[model samples]
Target: MKVGLLFDARNPDGWRRPWARHYARILELCEESDLRGADGVWFTEHHLFADGYLPQPLTLAAAAAARTRRVRVGTAILQPALRLPAQLAEEAALVDLISGGRLELGLGAGYRLPEYALFGADLNRRFRQTEANIREVRRLWSDGGITPGPIQDPVPLWGGFYGPRGARLAGQLGIGLLHISRPMFEHYRQGLAEGGHAPQTARVGDLLPIILADDPEAAWPRVAPYLAHQMNSYRQAAVEGTDVPPPPLIRSDELRNRDPDGPWGMLDILTPEDAAKRIIEITQGLPVTQLIFWASVAGMPDDLVVRNIELVSEALPPLLQAAHPAHPAHGREREAGPPLAAEGGGRG
Candidate 1:
């Protein structure tokens, strides 16, 4: 299995840093992940959050691409409704080029109504717009008239689907799937089969929020604040009907007071051994090609986040070996990518 890092960069009150430093820290951590043999570095997109969540993920992807030599840089879920198709295509293509084609484009029909209104897009028609934008992007890439297209023949597309319709759309387009639900994954595979595509060709990534430390007893308290913030933020979105089948609230009181049995299906704070075992089980028998870890969640402190990255890196090789024995050992390690500019590139 390919191991990667995902940064949402959500800066909650009392834990926030300067925006420039936050971005810089993310890249610095990306460099650390690459050095420690991570396969990719993924960024999430949000807008107008109280904590100043990342709003421009493709731009962030470009920044990540510039800083590291090997780690694949990607946007976890860039809303297609927010940009003109051609303009989005141009920006993505440039990032892919700068990264030497190491870009995984994950597109989403954005959930937040406020975000849709802010961008002057119709929330109800966002999915349709997403579909149309993707088609236009494909056409642009195929057209010979367009200069400086993405270096990857088709630039790997990973559709972020939360429901059956989106699953079918992903299948019809033959792109990879991200943050997949089990039902959606089945639907997507079925759709692919109906479309005359090989089922094994489907790439699925599982997003798991994890933190590692020597003493779980000691670490959970430190990481719990950010975890609570992360969960509560999602809960609020779900309550607002942005995400359906609402996520369980990881209560702040429980975390702050170190309540045992805090929450399941959310943050998995474990020791290296436990984490490795759980990852193996969580990913086993699934189409999970990539295991994306949300390490620096809710803007956790730089030191704690770095330690989490180090622990995961140390455990990943063995975890990959046990979970995906068919592949060569080197598959667990990071692969070298494009040349890095002296000044590095894309930090907006």
Candidate 2:
């Protein structure tokens, strides 16, 4: 599986940086990820967020493409239902062109009702609208609706939808899936057959919301606050404008072992060895093409974040694909010990 980085460009209050400076850092990190052997650089989208969450992922995507020589630059998800099909197609094509055919266009039916309202889009019809937009985008790229078309004949398209229903739609539409859980993977394959598409047409990836450190227990204190900010922000936005009670804001220490199956899922911290094992379990016996980890958590500082990227890009991949080495009673591999998930940060 390709090692990828996910950047949301979220700068929470109390940890904020100037917007231009923050963006520049992202491009620099994208360059670093590429030079350091990372395979893809992915960004996420959000709108009207208090932390100034990235609203235009494509803009950064183009910049990242230009900066990196080899990494594929893409969106973990761009909300298609909120944009005019033609305009979105044009922008995505430009990004692809800048990347020299290295764009993975992931589209999702976003859950943020406020984002829909901001664009005068109907939230209830988001899935159908997104499906139509996907068709329109394909036609635009292939049928000459777009000028000076994208470098790739059909830019690798993916559905960044959540849950079984969204997975099925991705299958019927015959696109790749960016799912987070094992159950969703099953649903996506099922949808592929239901839509008369070959199951082999399936390409899947997971947004593994994890942190890798040499010593996870030691890193928890430094990592928890930023992680908490990231999760709590998502939690609040999810229930915005709804009668449903918002989940309680997560605390830093509590994140050490919260419910993985709970609403605000666990933010796991793992050693490279343990992380590889967790990823294997997450994607084992599945067609997982990519595995992505967040580049930073709510604008986490580079000192703490960059090392993880280096480990993910370099140290981790080898362990994942290699045969198990015989370990001494006390060894680097032994440092990983039992799975971190047993503490509630992984698949339950």
- Candidate 1: minimum summed lDDT over ten consecutive residues — where? 339-348
Give the Å error, residue 189, model 1. Answer: 1.3
* lDDT score for candidate 2 against the true structure: 0.81
Model 1: runs farther than 4 Å from truth?
239-250, 255-264, 328-348
lDDT by residue (tens digit), candidate 1, 1-348:
676788887877776666787677678778878877777888878887778788889888888888888778888889988888889889999899999989988898978877888889898898899999998898898894366899999888988887898888888788888864677788888878877888878878867766777787877766777778877886676446354466677765575444456533667677877887876775556677777777676876566676677766656656567656786324544443342222222221
List RMSD in Å for every model shown: 5.4, 7.2
Pull out the clashing pairs in model 1: none
Scored by lDDT, the top model is 2
User: Which lDDT value does model 2 have at 6?
Assistant: 93
lDDT of 2 by residue, 178-258 (tens): 985678888998889988999888988868878788888877888777888888888999989789899988888677676
In candidate 2, the residue pairs with backbone N, CA or C atoms under 3 Å apart (3 or more residues apart, or in different chains) clash, namely none
